[model samples]
Target: MRLSNTLLALGLTAVEATQFWHNTGTKSGWDAYTHEHKGTVDEVTDQVYKGSTALRMTQIHDSSYSGRYHSEAVKFNAYKKGDTGFYGFAFRLQDNWQFSPAQGYNLAQFITDFSDLNCGEDYMPSTMVWIDGDQLATRVKYGEVCPTDQQKIKSFDGLKKVTAGVWHRVEIQASWKSDNTGFFKLWYDGEKVVEAYNLPTNVGDGRPFQFRVGLYANAWHDHGYEGTQGTRQVWYDQIAAGDAFADAAPDKW
Candidate 1:
């Protein structure tokens, strides 16, 4: 479908913030998940599933923070073959956080060499919908893997870069033009970053997998590395899931 037509059909607009669950750091809010550190780390607050609590991570032992936070309330439905939609998030990762496989899924993350001492060597799986491949963020190894036929499309290395330790917005839009004409695009901080046409596969098309928003930390699998002595934290706010409608349109039904 043409971008203009798709936008019209979706009526792209910002829905009421209240329609979403606010997970921040505050009192009397939803708690999707929370963990506290004992050593040098402290308490990490959770406002998961639209609460007023801030997700927190405290620093303690070897080259990293001790806690991690994630929300259980926000989840996405699996897409059919021709289904199309948009997804995005904004977050910040702390510096002290170690590069471990067990980081779980931080709303914000840091990517490093898998062989690095601090950087753990393991593929952290995310519940988030992504083109199937070995390298999670970039398409350095192969390309977009189509679930239906196991076909590979454009090189994923063209995808935008995600800067660590900073707050940025990464937005993705997937639409079906025809069985073979569908495409996907990503935007960073309102700037178009990556656009791919004629995707090898169609999402939401008879696939049994639904998109999920969560974190995956594989550090626990590393040898000689025990779980974080304390908790590491990343904060995610203003998360929404649904189809994108007309430009600047509110996301209300």
Candidate 2:
């Protein structure tokens, strides 16, 4: 669902502002959908968290293909430099997922294109959530979107224990601010794992960043599929963004 009038404004009391809700039951509702190499994003009915269907994101490691592995659904204009919003999604890993000696598997991110700066970086991401080993982690990227002294990223790891073959809820609420006046809070399965205030939630640029949720096997690109399982599967459902938690939460709305 693009930023449009038809987007869902969900809540006990709708905020009267533009919000988004996608059940992940279909492939045609998102602003954009993308995949790479042997990766695929499909709607599946066998495993679902909401409605009758959910999105299954799969990625196969191809040693011959040296590209980023991603199968994601994108929502544009999710936020900017000075906006505040809540984003939530429910995801489940494959029943046979390998956790020991685990590599990185990115689940969601807020990214924006910064090619206009030509700083050797293309689309730089601001906030990202992922699973590292058996723990869930997240990060915040700040500084100028271009070549600058302050361009840097800081990570927060060991948030919670991650399990496979089960539904897990993730909710992130942020007050986007370039200065040290913003706040970022993340909830994992209704447990508040990370909470920080007076921090830089994103870069100083004003470009509109998109919220994307899926299986992005970035470890394959950087660390070379360390796990024995070349084919990875993850299911996502009830992806949403809104002005408040109830509007974006899968169970609340």
Candidate 3:
């Protein structure tokens, strides 16, 4: 029996199991997380999913850059073509979150720099998760990155309502392909919310996309901030990515 167990352990290491990357947000540095925001990005121990720390992103209304307040954490070069990956994260909105009419608050995304193309678009995002008021939404972008108007965006709205002061899990499994053979799936709080097959989910060009998760007050930049809450905050923890569902699931890792 001892010999059999030894063989099994060796076999398990031969194949890559679910988790490829995981972050409990307990680290002191931001070496694994990158973002371009002049706002607050820090680690707090007041709340978390499974560890002693959680990443807190706070965005306040700024009149400096025409209401552009972005406080997000990104994992650069997270995905490429022909790669199937599952991403999972736990997030919590502030208890004082104000839910007004429809407004956009981006949560997570897969983006990359497209400035070399000289196509009027500098940075392009292929997949994104956001909140429309208190409702959760996501989308998958198709077509090439150029002109700023040629890309095809397939949006899935009203997945689940965001409950303030609570923890929610979001998981997405996607097949990155420039062709029409790719697929996209999303799960919210252990429930499958999105399933689409035979669809192109990325740009045709061969480039890696960076995955980001945080609070982007885009509505303030787009619609000029209509909500009553000026200071917005969100906590993120147990972020992971991998080839299998268990690898990225919150409870599994």
TM-score leader: 2
Clashing pairs in 2: 1-30
Ranking by TM-score: 2, 3, 1
RMSD for each of the candidates: 10.8, 3.1, 6.1
- Could you tell me which 10 consecutive residues in candidate 3 have the lowest summed lDDT? 1-10
List the candidates' TM-scores in order: 0.49, 0.92, 0.89
136-170 per-residue lDDT for model 1 (tens digits): 24221112233313323344442444444555555
* Per-residue error (Å), model 3, residue 119: 1.4
Name the 10 consecutive residues with the lowest summed lDDT in model 2.
7-16
Pairing residues by index, what is the TM-score of model 2? 0.92
Which stretches of candidate 3 lie above 4 Å from their native place?
1-16, 27-38
Off by over 4 Å in 1: 1-74, 98-155, 158-164, 176-179, 202-205, 218-231, 245-253
lDDT of 2 by residue, 210-234 (tens): 8889999999898877858899999
Candidates 1 and 2, the one with greater TM-score: 2
Error of 3 at 27 (Å): 4.5
